[model samples]
Target: MASKSAKKVNLLDHNSIKHILDESVTEVVKNQGYVEDVRLSNAKLLIGTSIIVVALIAQFYKKKFPENRDFLLACIALYVLFNGLLQLISYTKEKNAILFTYPPAGSFTSTGLVVSSKLPRFSDLYTLTIASADPKSISANEPVHFTKSITGWFTNDGVLVEGLFWKDVEGLIVQYTKEPKKSK
Candidate 1:
C-alpha cells in the first residue's frame, strides 16, 4: 500500500483531474451553437415581409395623406435611413458564415475558429455572411455549436445572423469569442 503522504498526493491529483474535466464540459456547452432549418427559413421570410410592409406604408402615406405629403415623405425617408443604419450596425456586430471546403463528420465547439469578416447586403432584403478563420475541411454529419452574443440589435435580424452562424457551425467552422463588445 502507498504511504500516507503518497495517498494525500493522489487525492490532490484526483481533485485536479475532476476540475479539468468539469471545465472542459462547461466550455463545450458554452461554445455550442445550434440553429434549426425552419428558423432560418422563417427569418428570411420575416425580413422579406418587413421590406414589403415598409414599401406599402410609404405608398399609403403618400396617397392618403397628400395634404401632409411633406410630413409623410419625411417619415418614410427617416424610416428607410434608420432601417439601413440599423442593418449596417447589425452586420458589423454579428458573425457571418464559415464557408467550408469540406464538411465535418463529428461535433465540435466554436472555440478554436476565428471570425474573418461579416458581410451585409441590401438588394431586396437584408442578408449577411460571416467568413471563418480556417479553411473548410470537415466530415459529414458533424455536430457543431456556434457561440454568439444574442443581446443586441433587433431580434429578427439578430436571430437571422445567429442562424447563419449556426449553419456555418454545421459546416465545421465555429467562430465565437468570449469577449464580445456590448453596444451602448
Candidate 2:
C-alpha cells in the first residue's frame, strides 16, 4: 500500500489579491460618491428656488408697501450672500477617489489594537495587530501595529481569529479605535 501526502495549498499571488481588493474598493467608493453628489445637487436646487421665490415676493410687497422696501432689500441681500457661500463650500467638498492597496500575504505581530481610517466609517479600511504563533515564526511572536502606511482593503466581514495548528498564539483580536469623520 502506498502512503499519500496531503497537498498544501499555496496562498494567492500578490497581483491577484491586489486586483480583487481594487475592484471591491472601487465599487464601494463609486456608490458612496454617487449618493453624495445627488444630495449636494438637490441642496443647490432648493436654495436657488427659495431665493427666486423670496425675490418675487419682495417685489410684490415693495410695490404695495413702499415703507417696507428697505427691510425687504436687506433680507434678500442676506439670503443671496448665504446662498453664494453655501455654493462655494459645496464646490470645495472633497470628491476624489481614495486609493486602497491590500498588504501582501505575510505574518505580522499583534499590537493588540486595531484602528480604522476616517474615510469610510461604517465599513472602511482598517489596521490590525496580527499575532504570531511561534517565536521562530515570521514575526517572532511580537506585537505588530499596522498604520496607514500599510495598505489594506475595507471589509465588514471580520477575519478568523482561531486556528487548529498554531500553539503559541492564544488567538487573534481585532477592534476599531474610532469612528470615521461624518460628512455634512
How high is the lDDT of residue 33 in model 1? Answer: 37
Model 2 TM-score is: 0.29
Which stretches in model 2 have alpha-carbon errors above 4 Å? 1-37, 62-65, 94-184
lDDT by residue for model 2 (1-184), tens: 1113321221233433334433333333333221112444566677777877777777766355668877787867967886886668455532222232222124233222111123233333333333222325432334443333112222223221112211111122221212234599
Tell me the number of clashing residue pairs for each predicted model.
11, 3
Judging by TM-score against the true structure, name the best candidate: 2
lDDT of 1 by residue, 80-173 (tens): 7657855764475333432222112243533123222222222112222223334243312222343333222113321222333334433333
In model 2, the clashing pairs are: 109-144, 110-143, 110-144
Which 10-residue window in model 1 sums to the lowest lDDT?
Answer: 1-10
Worst 10 residues of 2 by lDDT: 160-169
lDDT of 2 at 173: 22
